[model samples]
Target: MQLGLLYSGGKDSTLAALVLERFYDITLVTAHFGVTDEYEHARQAADAAGFEFRALELDREVAEEAVERMREDGYPRNGIQHVHEAALEAVADLDFDAIADGTRRDDRVPTVSRAQAQSLEDRHGVDYLSPLVGFGRNAVDRIVDAELDVEVGPSEEIPRADYEAELRAVLAEEHGEGAIREVFPDHDQTYVHGLRE
Candidate 1:
């Protein structure tokens, strides 16, 4: 079956791709709001990972709304969660049998509840999969170490194609760079280089 995986060029997403590699024809897709060219980074990672790649355009209004919500909330969890749901819905609209993401069991945000997953599947007529949802950080890290090469650093330093990047750009453009720092705390981000040889 054909599957579209929401990819961010990060370890979790990349590892999710690897886990699903044998079961489906996977296309690594990056959802972007057209606010920046960061999607190109995901494209490169897809190439290195040897998967078909596509940049799916998301509604810019969603980004705008998410940024506004983040600004008001003074944190990114809700806004980021909103974008992630939108992204999953967007991916479900594609002509694939399944849609997947890298959200894990332990993640504090961006999680899809069982009801939400069922709703997505029921509405879209496609299975929604999250390959890493059952795995903890240690298990995921061990698999990533065995299967992929990654670059890890502070969030701003890492080149990535995820909601956070576009959100930061939008937040910065409208509010200011300081607003970005205010909304998003400093955390490590990862960029996958490729699978191990």
Candidate 2:
């Protein structure tokens, strides 16, 4: 089974690829927002992971539209949902049948919309296989630790929180802070606090 991995270069996503690669023809697909720093980090991860990598670029307009929709509807909101769809589309031209993600069963909870997982299976014939489904974050960390050669890269200088804050700030300026919180309520504060001046 040839599979396209929706990799973010994060440990979870990388571990997902490592697991699935055992059974499938895996190609790495990473989505970027066209920022130089983010793109470079992703590329480094891809290179280190040793998979042929493909890039999907989403610009500010796309991000804004999705964030706006997500704010109104909630998790698995239209915007975030579309990001996965766009990933599938980005790799549609490639030679793969299933697109896999790094979602663990632990991640399969009430908070994440079921529609997103169902949509992936229904629309793409792709199996949303969470190989680490039964494992929690700790287990993932342990597995990653066990595989010292996995080559997980260093933490980003600005970190994801910084990006989240930047996005939130932009959204607030464009719409309002209330709108951003409504859209991304669980925005990881580590990014926000770390990046704050």
Candidate 3:
């Protein structure tokens, strides 16, 4: 089966692609609001993982809507979910047998709920899978450590394919740094430094 894997050029997504490669034809897909250097990074990561790579440009309006939703909700959980759903919806038009993401057991945001997953399969006829859903941080870390060479740092410090990165930049530029700080809040943002060895 051809699997469209939502990639972020991070350990989680890269590892997920590797795991699924055994059973499916993996195509790494990265979504961005506009032109970004992150796409190049994602391409390199996909090359390292030995998978085909594609970057999909998401509508800027979606990012705006997500920011607005975050402003209204007073948190980023809903906004992040909105972006994720938008990305998935954007990719749904492609001719892929199934869609997958790197959401782990511990992931709280950017994850499809059971209802949402069912809706995708039922309405869109696309199966949504999260290969790392059953794996915890420790197990995931061990696997990546053993199989991949990665550099980890705060989300801000690392350059990778992250939906929130563009959204945050736009929000900060249009609104202010305070807007980003308020919406995203203080959190641990970790990202993979580069392609796995």
Best by TM-score: 1
TM-scores of the candidates are 0.98, 0.64, 0.91
lDDT by residue for model 2 over 63-177, one digit each (tens)? 6665666666754345655555555555554667777666666653212246766766776666656566667878876877775243322232334311233345556777776
Q: How many clashes in each structure? A: 0, 3, 1
> lDDT per model, in order?
0.94, 0.57, 0.83
lDDT string for model 3 (76-148, tens) is 8888888999888877768899999999999888777889889987877898898999999999989988887
With a 3 Å backbone cut-off (N, CA, C), the pairs that clash in candidate 3 are: 155-189
lDDT of 1 by residue, 144-191 (tens): 989999999999999999899999999999988899988999899999
lDDT of 3: 0.83
* Runs off by more than 4 Å, candidate 2: 35-37, 59-61, 69-82, 85-94, 108-119, 148-197
What's the distance in Å from true for residue 112, model 1?
0.4
Summing lDDT over every window of 10 consecutive residues in candidate 1, give the lowest-scoring window: 173-182
- 1 or 3, which is superior by TM-score? 1
